[model samples]
Target chain A: MSAPLLSVKDLRVVFSVGGTLSRLRGHVTAIEGVAGVSFDIAKGETFALVGESGSGKTTLARTLNGLQKVASGSIHFDGKDATSMGRAEMKELRRRAPMMFQDPVGSLSPRLDVRALLAEPFRIHGMSDRDLDAEVRRLLTLVGLPVDFASRYPHQLSGGQARRVGVARAVALDPQLIIADEPTAGLDVSVQGEVLNLLNDLRDRLGLSMLIITHNLHVVRQIADRTAVMYLGRFVEMGETEAIFRSPAHPYTAALLSANPEPDPDRVHDRIKLPPEVPSVMARPSGCEFHTRCPFAQDLCRRNAPPLRVNGGHQLTCHFPMNTPAQAGLEQAQ
Target chain B: MSSIRGSRGAEMTMTTDQNTPAPALDIDALSVSFATDGGTLHALKDVSFSVPKGRITGIVGESGCGKSTLINAILGLLADNGEVTGGAIRLGESADITKLTPRQMRDLRGLQISTVFQDPMGALNPVLSVGKQMRDIQYRSNLSKREKDARSVEMLRQVRIPDPEKRLTQYPHEFSGGMKQRVAIAMALMMRPQLLIADEPTTALDATLEVATIELLKELQQEIGCAVLFISHHLGVIAELCDDMIVMYAGEVVEQGSVRQIFRNPSHPYTRALLDCDPARLHERVKHLPTIPGTLPDLRNRPKGCVFQARCALAKPECGQPVTSVEVTPGHIARCIRTNEVTA
Candidate 1:
């Protein structure tokens, strides 16, 4: 088999947080944003990092696109050591790996019209203005936005239009891989569908690898080929999308799948409710971060962190991994 | 909490009559408009829906579809420039809410009806502790400090906020997003109001947290026996938690029916389109999602006939005429001229 396009090993990102007052109190806390995480993404594949807020999914995406600093561990991107890349190499890497932001309203330049926003990438890459206009129009059409909308400012566009502009900007440089952070986050379902379709189309046509970071399971089901479920800066389950949805080996993954609300009223779901709140990342648990909320957490789970183990093409980090009752029932029926 | 409601017994009786089976809320051709500088924006156009006693009624629409305007009109909380041009909001058999003065409405607010907004921080005070805010809501009540504190703690526990006593002493900032929503839910239910208006209460939380919050809302609604008017843009949420649903488009209700009937046999083209667009409903992979072709018609330039005709796929030339709502099934109504031909 061909090597993966991106490989990350034992990645860690730590930050020191404190002010002068905290210094007087002798308390400077370190926040481990991404703690010893590892993953690989093959070319022309859609890999999703699914997690809620404070789960460090965003941090991991930022690291992938060179926007975030890596405190430790190694990253091999397109056969290059990303962590040790110098200034020129970093710039080149950035050109090949573009990022789509979560908030299109904030990401798109308010002062500039859509034409300029989309054309700026080409200008930055030293393309002449003659080619820029054509490229801008092409990108806009690619994302299904009208050519006339190219003259509209960011504020003038609707939520769905602004998101299309975000996608248009991300793909302007014709990058190999796109990192979209909650691309359809605040959009309505119809609009979200449009964006997802655009993403799926672009991935297939351009033969681009994508790293989609979101908390939405529906999006994961619709677009992702493989997925990694993250919780508090660590991957709890990683495998094929269908397999994870069918039989989530980790308790957190099962709980998350159950929590997803289906649109069909006939298919009434009984969700597995987690205990009150996800604990603060600053004071993470001593062993497995999820042990405090895991329904099947045992003493061994609370005392020692479980290592990721491979089983049936699934990588799960749970001491006693088992399929949920729903999955088990389906298996029994089969 | 009981004492607080007891103190406002007169106001409660005034709003809710002793009629045996009166719906919690009823609106008859309610119309709301805002006097903008350009022209009068018809925020809500002859909207009508009822919240049955002890049942959950959901209103689903896009952001500018006037779902919020309908909720605002119910609470008499529209903006200064906005006005109710026509129609009546009947609260049970006793009160026509449109006729109530601001003072009377204020008196009836927490006693008879309360709201839980999407952003809990906007509803809560950052400087005040959770307990302080709860006490502030009951300032008009005759309860003592100790009783108020105990009641607040009890309400917190009722929402399943772990360490309820410790949580009350903390400020809103100390609570997580999910926890803040729980606190907000707890505060809304503290008054034991007959009607609970939850406007996108779980939109800000994650999917997992959203499920938990909705479960809590359902549990609390059943326990309090309050008629809940849940307004959300998420169809999945409406399907899961709502008993009945109202589909809105351009300030008008395009469809209203039992949740089961609407999902299983939708008659409106818009509702059918919405159901088709849902990612969860798709099992096969398609390159492009089937999109409803056109954008929502501007409220100011709303079409003369069917508001949804501009974007509807099955629209005909006769759609330009006034569309009449037809009862496709028992208790299932759709505001479309071709309801006979269309099927889910």
Candidate 2:
């Protein structure tokens, strides 16, 4: 009911390819990394961006965090426009919305101990006047790490422990939003459960909104309130997580869901095996970006780009969506 | 060789069936220790399993579970400081791999036992063409150049790589991740090895490619009739691709059974915990996922009792004593003192 915590509208990030020679010759090529994406995250809501590598999920996250410059459109965070924010405002925005990178150990300074890593955020945000020691201990305890871990360096901690430390640093500023990229990656199954539980617990306890970018659909299914399936830097499907899993509107969403290997051996897995190659962003397919890989693709799909069709909260960009009889019936009525 | 005979005799007595053909690879009471700076780290202890002929046996475990060590021991490529402390790795009919010299092991590696690693780029030569690399893998064979080339093409075709002849000329960089992995698999099966060791071969690929690769592996294994040892940390992949699975915990095989049996009813506390931890197994959204409580025991000074005792929820004071495996059912076993209580 309240205003959304983060609102991104028509966000686009582009990068110029080739060297200065191509620019001098007036033949420079540009690639759209995050091509005109839009989404909103309500307060305390967990939103997930699911796609394979180079699908611009990470780029979009970076753009929101102000790590990457947006070519167009706006990022409104906590009732403030982040795109046009000056240095001080951007610095404040960074404090309120911290980014947790993929590699836990690599992201943390190897030289710094857990205490310093936790304190660094407060110091950067000009909040070092408070008791840093107590704050460090509090963060460690919050993330379910032992208080003794404060003295340990990044290399000393295991993968799961390092990830917890990363979590502690992300929440150090008491941020309203936490953008985690592949939060459970490279962890063992049991450890992954621990990390997920911690994140879930933190979300509930702190009342924080989250934007999770991951290729692991299992994570999305478990944690996300809502999800968006990105293909070639744009969302092919966006809707309630349960609805998306139950009956995917876009063919790409169905393919992704079926492709995830379920742990049960008894369940027959009829995987939608797409053609191996992912089309380059520079040379995206005409019309539907996923038409090349979509098993149900037809002549009409390749001729024109599909509009974002909305039915209730579910949205899809496909010429012929799958597994939504109600939406099909509605379209027929229209 | 004579010293390993007693263990082989013991293994034979344990086998329930006499008519079944000899397993492609039999690892009997195998123990591997690495001389680390801290101490002699026992990476694998009393690890016993059989890769049955023409069947897929998966080894599933997290990091430090010694799956890699077992593979290295089988391939005779353990690090210089690592040693086979005890027991035997009997490959096919005659050889106890631990006793084999470097020369003998090299001769047996490619022809008798081939391996497909996780990263295809690392497995393949970046400078050389795919055709050249595939052809060169058969250097031990007496086949002619043209014959090897033809065999390479056939192998690629079997893996369903489009336009095998044209794709062969392209280098590793030219192929996509899935295609490169396919190429790696084709090359590994080129010799029709008695046993194939795939160490997390599909972990690097996307979800679609991962399932596709799993299906291809299943089809190819059936076609080649070679025993496969599929090692992965993913429970889902192991469940889907393997016929039999060995669940390792802290360098010890905690449970071993048919995939169907294990998935349906896991006997060991560790196995049950691991299965519960998998997000794919959980249908409903829960507030907190079940997690194994503690970290793996230090390898240098492993606990006297069960390796997973500290983390196991069903552990008892009696579990402080060293435990041997208990047969839950025919062909299903768990190495835990509380197996009876838990299974009951």
Candidate 3:
């Protein structure tokens, strides 16, 4: 088998707050109970990480990007261990690790013009200053922005325009991988569509591999080749987008699908009303993590942890795979 | 909550007031323009729609489409810079909402029509107890203090809030996002306004909570028999709760018709793109999810041709006509000049 472009195993990150609290007794458990979590991203393929707020999706993303320090885990990139790599080595990786943030305006420097912003990445990687201007113009044209806008500052551009500039900046170093975090959160629907199209074009034209972390399912449906569904801190299901949406295997996966409002109004959206909120990580339930909220909670669920099993190239972490909506309903009723 | 009747559980009772002759809210070709630092920006253009007595009419558009501006104009509460250049919005029969004096508008606002904003957390005061705020709004009502208390609790019950009597004393932070919206609705109904203008009230909530809130609103409308002007960006939400829908873009009504008519036969390119935008829009998988191409044009230098022509793939030379709109059906209409070219 061909080697994967990126791979991670048993990744875990924890932050300990310090102050007037006791020296020995740790304060504030931000994230815990994360078991062996693993995934891979192939060349020119898009992998998606989906979960609601505070489900550890952001933490995992940061860890993968080498922004956040990890406690115990192994991250292999291009067949090398990146966990303990030096700053210079990581900087070499960072040159290729272009990231697009959620807020485009906030991400770009307010005082810098678009051309300077786009050229910074190229200059940082020791590329020639003479070629920078030509490269900036090419990147701007590729992103579908007019050359005149290069002279304008970030504040002068519209929200959509600013996002395009941010994309150009990320791809400035000619990176093989792009990690986008909620790329379209606050933008208008039309603008969001435009930005999505730009990203799609970039992926196809550049042959870029992408790892998109988002809470919006619509985004996943549009760009993802495969999806990983996260609950608390672990992936409950990982499969092709069509399989995940059409026949979600895990009970938690099925419940989440049931809970999301169907975009079509003619069809009454089925909702599995989970109690008010998900529990905190400090008090995560034992055995099967989702058994507490599972409608089919039994003695076995509370006594044993479920292992992720493979079925027709899909991985599901549920004792009983609930595929169809009717089957999920029956499990709940039982 | 005591001010309005919500016909939530009365499914058959909703039709009772729709057949009535009197118009509850009348907005005629209303246009609101803003004087920004840039230039004279026409936010709303010759927009016209009316809500029948006890019927729900939904207005849907994304940001900058002036959905909220239209609702605020009905209350005669435009920002310091905004002005209505043309048209009239009359509420409760003869009261021309645009020309009402400050004092008269005050009397007309809560008593005749109330607005439910999307952000319940921001709309509610965190410092004040819910009960005190309730009493403050209803102090001028005919009901006495004790009677108001009874009515307030009764209104809470009507909306299906658990432990209404206890909850009234707690602050807004004590409730969840959905519950906070219900409280906001209860406050809007305190005057029993003839028209309840809900501006993306459910957008702030999750799917389960959002669906329930709409169900609650529908039941409340049935009981009160009051018209509701529901505004949202989600067509799905509008279709579930509204009898009629008005599609807006830039500053004009691109399409208007019964929800069923508009959903099944969207006559405008903008409307079709909107329906196809949702990834989960259909039970069956789409070969490719359709998306509107370009961002909406700047309101300052508005497009001379069809406002949506810049992004529309079906643009023909005839779509360049700027001064005409076509009626596509018995009660449905679109502003696009290519009415015959595009099929619903």
Number of the predicted model whose lDDT against the real structure is largest: 2
lDDT digits (tens) for residues A1-334 of candidate 1: 5988889999999877887787789774678899888888899999999988889999988887778899999999999999999988887787788889988788998999998998887777766555777888899889998899978998998899999999888888878889999999888888888888889999999999999998888888889999999998988899998888777788788788778777778774655668867887778887777999988788998899887798765898888887646446322110
Error of 2 at A59 (Å): 1.2
The residue ranges of model 3 lying beyond 4 angstroms of the native Cα positions read A15-36, A123-130, A259-265, A268-271, A302-304, A324-334, B1-19, B103-112, B124-192, B202-213, B216-226, B282-289, B294-298, B301-306, B309-325
Q: Rank the candidates by DockQ, best first.
A: 1, 2, 3
Off by over 4 Å in 2: A19-28, A324-334, B1-15, B142-149
Off by over 4 Å in 1: A19-28, A123-130, A268-270, A324-327, A330-334, B1-20
Which numbered prediction scores highest in DockQ against the true structure? 1
Estimate the TM-score of every prediction. 0.92, 0.93, 0.84
lDDT per model vs. reference: 0.84, 0.87, 0.77
Clashing pairs in 2: none
| Tens digits of per-residue lDDT for model 3, B220-283 | 9998989999998766678788888888888887887778777877888888888777555644
- Residue A152's lDDT within candidate 2 is 94
Which 10-residue window of candidate 2 chain A scores lowest in summed lDDT? A325-334
TM-score of 2: 0.93
Residue A190 lDDT in model 2? Answer: 86
**lDDT tens digits, residues A148-200, model 2?**
99999999999999999999999998899999999988899889989998999
Clashing pairs in 1: none
